[model samples]
Target: MKYVDEFRDRDKAAILVREIGALAACIGRQIHIMEVCGGHTHSIFRYGVEGMLPSRIELVHGPGCPVCVLPIGRVDACLGIAEQPGVIFTTFGDAMRVPGSRKSLMQAKAEGADIRMVYSPLDALAIARANPEREVVFFGLGFETTMPSTALTILQADREDIANFSVFCNHITIVPTIRAILESPDLELDGFLGPGHVSMVIGTAPYEFIARFHRKPMVIAGFEPLDILQSIWMVLKQIKDGRAEIENQYARVVPEAGNAAALRAVAQVYELREFFEWRGLGSIEHSGVQLRAEYARFDAERKFAIPNISIADPAACQCGEVLKGLIKPWQCRLFGSACTPETPLGALMVSSEGACAAYHQYGGKVQRAETA
Candidate 1:
């Protein structure tokens, strides 16, 4: 609670909010500040940070949730491997609810597939070790934050000679996806609140393009309310001074160069894909990772012959637009009515890290208070 309580202090938050309001007043016109991480989105809504901001300043949620961005085709491929005889499919719980073209992994589990919800890739390895005969497939999903651990697990599996254990690699890079967002013509974002967790691994250097090329300021931010507040102030301060630059507010965890040993593990086990399909963002070049050639024995794609076909997102679900910050979650017709969390029609509704889900659970209460 030491770090947390200090960040959450109401008195400090009030002072920061007043400073941010003054800064926003100087900007004078409507400014769209995008928080390119789901954790920041969650913090904003949870702590009423959005409500505290000046009316002219808007916080747009970007495509940062890895599970939210995971394409349906990938889910279908996972189902194919999961349904295979004598195969054990293991994945994070959030991924099980993501709807494929036909059915979700949850549906497959109900219909008798050996599907297990695992917290980590190492858990899947343990399952493989316990059952030497059955093939254990770990459905890897996330950004750079989780990649090194999964990569390390694969290395461990290779060293231990766990013949039955393999990973269905779906790990994505944040920078490419951010580049994709910046390239979109419809998006008129002024600044960004960068992801702290991903920066902790990949570091601040990768985000220089946001300021250098795109001419938008970015503050690498932590998940805490005060961290987010200070980050907003930093971005607004950049705008006030007409300076576009990348700054780090969460430097306590994220280094300027990032973790060297973690990078080594990732380099050893994985390589960049030519292009990877995102659920909302479509295919972005070099945005995904796959098992390296040396680790071919632990590659799930090679181990199982999967039907790798693209499945289009639902017509009613405006997840793509929502992800791009074109509209709020409630603006989508299917959001609360057809796409409730209990019966989610889009990937964003299924994942807690998703902007839509965060907005639904946390946004409304604060919004109403502010509006009132």
Candidate 2:
């Protein structure tokens, strides 16, 4: 609570807000700063950060939710693997609700598939340990923050000679996705609130491209309200000074060089795929990772005969444009009326970290006030 209580201090928040307001006035025009993590998106909405900022400042949501960006094809693939006769499919609880082409994992489980919710890949490994005859496949997903645990789990599986355990790797890299967003012809981003958890593992070095090549200021930000306010102030300062560089506002957790052990584990277990499909963003080169040949024995793709196929997103869902900051979640016609969390029509409404779900759950009143 030492880190958390201090970050949530009201006096510190007020000071940061005042400083941010002054910076906003100095800019004197619209400035869009993206928080490239779904956790940040949820925090922003939950803390009413959108309402706190000046009208000229817009906090655009990025495609940082691993579950939101996971393509329907991949979900279908996961479902395919889950439905196998002898397999026990394990995945994070959030992923159970994500709809594939036809149904969700939860739905599949309700219909008699051997689906399970696991907190970690190690939990899936434990399941494999308990069930020797049943094949246990863990659905892997997320950025660098979660990749180390999966890598270490695979290593553990190998060490114990857990022949029945495997992983369905859907892990993605943040840098390439950010690059894709920056390269978009319609982009109007002035700066970025970098992903803190991912930065903790990969370090600040990978984000240099945003500053050096794309000429955008980036601050690796923590998930606290005051931390967000301070990060926004930092980005504004960079823009005012006409400097573009990567800064770490969450220095307490994220180091400049990152964690060497995590990086080594990731490098040992996984290799970047040439291209991977995102639900909204399409296929971006080198955006996803897969198990290395050395770990092929524990690779779920090799272990299961899944229906490897692509499934297009629902035509009515504007998740792609929403992800690109072209529109807010409410702007989509299907937002609250058709795509409530109870029955998500888009990927964004399904996950707690998702922008649509965040706005729906916490930012609805703020959004209404803005419209009024």
Candidate 3:
């Protein structure tokens, strides 16, 4: 309660709001600050942070949710792997519900495919150890924060001589994707709310380019309301003082250098792919990780033969524009009405950390006020 209660003081929150309002008025321009973490998006909405801010300050959501950015083709590929003889597919719970071209992994599970929801790659490796005769594939997906854990599991499997264990790597980096968003002609961002968890892996050095080249202020924030508010204040202060730099609001958790051992583990097991497909962002160069040549035997794609197919998203979903900060979640015609989380028309709705789902669950009041 020491750290938690202190950051949530109502009086402190009100004072911060007043200060932010003053700063917003001083800027005199429509300042668009995008929060690149899905957790930050959820926190902002859940705490009504957007409603408390000045109207001039706009918070755009970025492609930070791993489950949301996973391409439909990748889901289909996982299904293909799951259906193979003597194969058991494992992944995080979120991936199970994300729809592929025709069916979700959950649907595949119901149809008798060996699809297990695992919390970590280690759990999948344990399964592989238990069933030595059957092939086990861990469907890995996330940004830098989760990659080290996956990398460690692969190393553990190799060390223990677990021949049946393989990895279907869909791990991506945050920096390259952020560069893509910043360089896009349609987006007009003034600053960035950098991802906290991803920063804990790659450190703050990678994000210096956003400030140095693009002159965009960035504040890496935690998931709490006060942490987000303090980060907003940091961004506003930088803008007010005409300084562009990277500031870490979640200093208690994230350091400037980050965890070196975890980074080394990821470097040991994976190499950057030339191009990787995202659900909405298409193929981003050097944005994803694949098993290195040394680890090819443990690569699921290499171990199995499957047809390559590219499928388009639903015609009505505007998830592409939404992810890129070109439009808001509510701007998508299918949002809430035709595409609720229970029956998502797009990946954005299915992911818990997705901008659309956050808006649907917590920003409905703000949406009504805007319409009124």
Candidate 4:
């Protein structure tokens, strides 16, 4: 309760809001601040922060949810691996629900594909140890926070000489994607609420580019109401003062240098791919990681000749726009009508941190009325 209660104090929150309001009046322009963490998106919606803010201060969602940004082709590739003879697929719970071209991993499991939900990569390794006869493929997907754990698991597997365990790496970097977003001609963001979890791994230095080059103010914040409010206030203050910089609001957990051991572990097993496709951003150069040549034996893609096929997204699904901050979730015609969490039209609906699902769960009625 020490950190939790202190950050959420109503008085502090009110002060931040008052400051933000004053800052907004001075700026006198539509200040678009995008929060690049899906966790932040959920927190923002859950706390009704959007409604509390000045109308001119808009918070746009970015490609923070790894599960949400996983291209449809990649999902299909996982499904294909799951269907292989004597193969057991392991992935985090979020991936189990994200729809592929035609079927989800959950549906595939229901239809007897031997897909197992794992809390961590170590859990998948344990499953592989238990079933020596079957090949265990850990479908790895996440940004920096989870990648270190997966990298460690791979190292452990190699040390144990686990022949059957392999990884399908889809680990993405946060900095490059942020650079891509800023470089894009379409997105006109005033500032960014950087990902706190990612900052814990890569540190605040990676985000200095946003401030130095793009001249956008950014605050790496934790996933709490007051943490978010304080971050919003920091961004507003920067804008008001006609200054741009990267600030760390969640300093208790994130150091400027970040977790060196975790980053070293990532470097040990993986190397950046030339390009990897994202749901919204398409193929951004060196945004994804693949197992290094030394660890090639543990790489699932190398172990199995899985066809890399490119599939088109549903013509009507506006997930691309949602990820790029071009449109809100409710702006998509399929949002509540055709794409609820129960029957998600795209990955955004399936992921808990996904902007569409967060908006639907927390701001559906309010969004509907406003849109109507």
Could you give the C-alpha RMSD of every candidate to the true structure, in order shown? 1.7, 1.2, 1.5, 1.4
Estimate, for each residue in 45-89, the C-alpha lDDT of model 4 and write its tens digit.
877888888888888888899988898899999998999989999
Scored by lDDT, the top model is: 2
lDDT tens string, model 2, 73-130?
8898998888889999999999999988799999999999999999989899999999
Q: Candidate 4, clashing residue pairs?
A: none
Worst 10 residues of 3 by lDDT: 363-372
Task: Judging by TM-score against the true structure, name the best candidate.
Answer: 2
For each candidate in turn, the TM-score is 0.96, 0.97, 0.96, 0.96
For model 1, how does the per-residue alpha-carbon lDDT over 230-265 read when each residue is reduced to its tens digit? Answer: 999999999999999989999999998999999999
For model 1, name the residue pairs that clash.
Answer: none
Residue 215 displacement in candidate 4 (angstroms): 0.8
lDDT computed for candidate 2? 0.91
Model 1 CA deviation exceeding 4 Å by range: 365-372
- Please, what is the whole-model Cα lDDT of each candidate in the order they appear? 0.89, 0.91, 0.88, 0.89
The list of candidate 2 runs beyond 4 A from truth reads none
